[model samples]
Target chain A: MRLNGNRSFSSFSFLALASLLALFLFFVTLLLSVFLYVGPRELASSLLSEEILFSIRLSLITATMATAACLLVAVPAAYALSRFNFRGKGLVDVLLYLPIGMPPVALGAALLIFFGTPMGGIFSARFVFEVPGIILAQFAVISALATKIMKSTFDGIDPEYESVARTLGCSRFQAFYKVALPLAKGGLITAVAISWIRALGEFGATVMLAGATRMKTETLPVAIFLNLETADVVKMSAAVLILAGVGLTALILIHKLGKRWPAV
Target chain B: MIRVENLSMRLGNFALTDVNLRVQRGEHSIILGPIGSGKTTLLKCIAGIYRPDSGRIEMDGEDVTELPPERRNIGYVPQDYRLFPHLTVSENISFGLRVRRSGNLEDRTRAMLDLVGLSDLSRQCIKCLSEGQKQLVALARALAIQPKVLLLDEPFTRLDSTAKVRLRRELRRIHEQTGVTIIHVTHDFEGSLNSRNRVAIMNDGRLVQDLSEIKKYLDEKLGYIPIDLRAGG
Candidate 1:
């Protein structure tokens, strides 16, 4: 029986290791296949093209703006959800989860409909089918995810620290900024990186709300769609590589910082 | 001075019902109870961390029932010390002063470090300190605000035997030196019985005995005579 148990344990470990390696190889091969369609010189020229350059710049600016707006709203919302018990708290929690549960295209369609309404029509001139629409869509989709991450971070911290700070003469806001915010540094970084990455790669919503215009509203994902439409696989592959490279660098940076801080 | 009048609170399955007690100015008092006897809950209520469903808490003739914890002018040292993990020893001690923007921040922080005898470890990180050192930091941090009353919830629960004895001595010395009213909560009977401080015993969320001398309460309530009292007799 002991020999049988040892054999079963080894089989389980083998199965898990094999599954991990299989998934690793699958992604590595999928990413490497993009290089087969374009040579180095073509890839460099495609990347330096005016339209692609504009797409890259637009994606960076919109993703940064969306991430900043998301944090401004998410930090306080998550703190309230983590710390307080109020009327309609359950309803508020469900509403915050709505965007995460909905498909990106459906969320985009909803935003399109809202823009047609009289209330949303007020801002339609500034946002609908414009560059700012990309940022608004990304913020809508990633804010829920950012809030969830921040809420988990706050939940891991003990409420006693705030209580002790209160007794130490810190007002509620002071305690939050001085003690709670500093302790949440690792989670804040995680939220910002994940949300920014998600915003950069946003496609279905960006195309739906921002209309995939050539240079005016074209982000990187929109650029990929346009290139694919014209069957320009070389430019498409270059754009894919650029997006993948940026996301990989961000993930690596987050990993390095996570090791250094190691989260409280 | 602290007075709790008809204080009652119910949290989930635990409740503190109609608990009343008083600690006089400059007096050291101990709230002795078993675990889950609402000792910490009572201390939190006194510190304004938890609002009782019904009660009036008066500190030095001021009824501060509706006040928030920050406005209460009380120093609280929770169980586990709760030193801000991100800050160093001196920073933890000076947190109250910094938040209030009190003048002479450096001199005050240094004085607190000296009072706790932790000046040498002032720059040390909170994670590097032993349990005893963390407790002292927590104590110094609390006392730095010069609160009218100090509420300590299970200050010695995590200490080893030697640390417990040493902390008890340190607490007594600090109490004498500052003349600050202190209400310490603990479950250790033998550990709390040594001091001449007033003892308030609690059971099932009620104060069974309030503001009585330690020896008199032990003899009358628990029928346990002290060795010194027997020798005197």
Candidate 2:
């Protein structure tokens, strides 16, 4: 009887621990959501601030460009990781992983220095301190994250599919473009959506590299920071509300697109 | 006819050295060996999946040692079946035909499915098939191309006794009906020796003996199974 009692107590204890952990996570998430809702926009006029409007526009445009460009670069990089064999292959894999762990500010600083240097001076002439600068900064941030995600997505696919395509008489590139790419559609869509959302929310990298100049380099996150400093709580809250709304919409779009992809 | 001359390869810890084999046209040849005997590697080399370090593979009097897998016109059924999991049974069967841009793909797919007795499961996903069903589907997929030489790597291991019997009968029937050359790799002596027209027993990556001396060789290496009279009657 004592032994049975002890066993019951242990099982109950385990269940209780699991319950508490889940409850803790649930409440934490619920609280953040409540803040996201109620902390922003008490009045109507605060929503029309010009800085808020400009930042919103810039954020959307830059994030879109960044996501598109990153995908262009990431697809080939992921394929190389998935299919190729060469010297320094392991080193390339390790290098790709480093960005996911490093601090975003450090990443921003590195980008700033690299781009600001003479070697960077050439490329920065095309991308820095302008509308293109914001896009470029966001591109750098998203590319780092996208490569990691895309690599895993491609790795999950079987090489046999490509081989089968080749045996069917497709060239190597044709096999990848037609067969491997089609099969990796789910992972690719998910990765792009995640990368887009991350680019949209990026503040640390954007602020350091792009420099939050209003009506130019100022993104939504930068606008929020600027308003918060002026203690204009109402305007700051309105901007936050709009940013959160957009982020939520993107998240919903991702879910919807995931469901509807492969229209065939 | 396919001929291999002094094939040698060094792959990590496992190796095949100075191997020679000759498979006649329209013959079912089984390569029997234990695990790690490099049967799969030999099949891969023949199918052009692996580059042998020093060897020549001649197919119909043409040297094809440097040919790529797709260019080899040989069919390979891997141990895992390696079916396209996302494709339906019909699609999987039609894959090679589609790749080859062959005519009447639908007809070929339907015929192969019928032969494998998988016509009922044609529209189902490859992942949803039973192990036996998967093996049949893989076989149908391989046959869709009507490959000149068929290479099967332990094709019967995943099957149950009933499925194994059915598949064996189907294989023998198919061989008879099509007259396609087959190179089967397996460790099962009963199936490899008793079922095949020619059998090669391998050890440590070498074809130690072909069927011409297999019975005598096996008796020397492994003693014969004892006959039981009292239990059977």
Please report, in order, the local distance difference test score of every candidate based on alpha carbons. 0.90, 0.79
Backbone clashes under 3 angstroms, per model: 0, 0
lDDT of 2 by residue, A128-179 (tens): 5566867777777778688887787788777766765555455678778767
Q: Model 2, residue A104: displacement in angstroms?
A: 2.1
How close to the true structure is residue A159 of candidate 2, measured as C-alpha lDDT? 78
Instruction: Name the regions of candidate 2 deviating beyond 4 angstroms.
Output: A1-50, A242-264, B210-217, B220-222, B225-233
| Candidate 1 Cα outliers beyond 4 Å, as residue runs | A1-9, B210-233
Question: lDDT (0-100) at residue A240 of candidate 1?
Answer: 95
Model 1, span A1-264: residue lDDT tens: 254345565776778778999999999998989887678899999999998999999999999999999999999999999999999999999999899999998899889999999999999988889989999999999999999999999999898999999999888888898888889999999999999999999988777788889899889888899999999998889889999999999999999888876667
* Lowest-sum lDDT 10-residue window in model 1 chain B: B209-218
Which prediction has the highest DockQ against the true structure?
1
Instruction: Give the CAPRI class of candidate 1.
Output: high
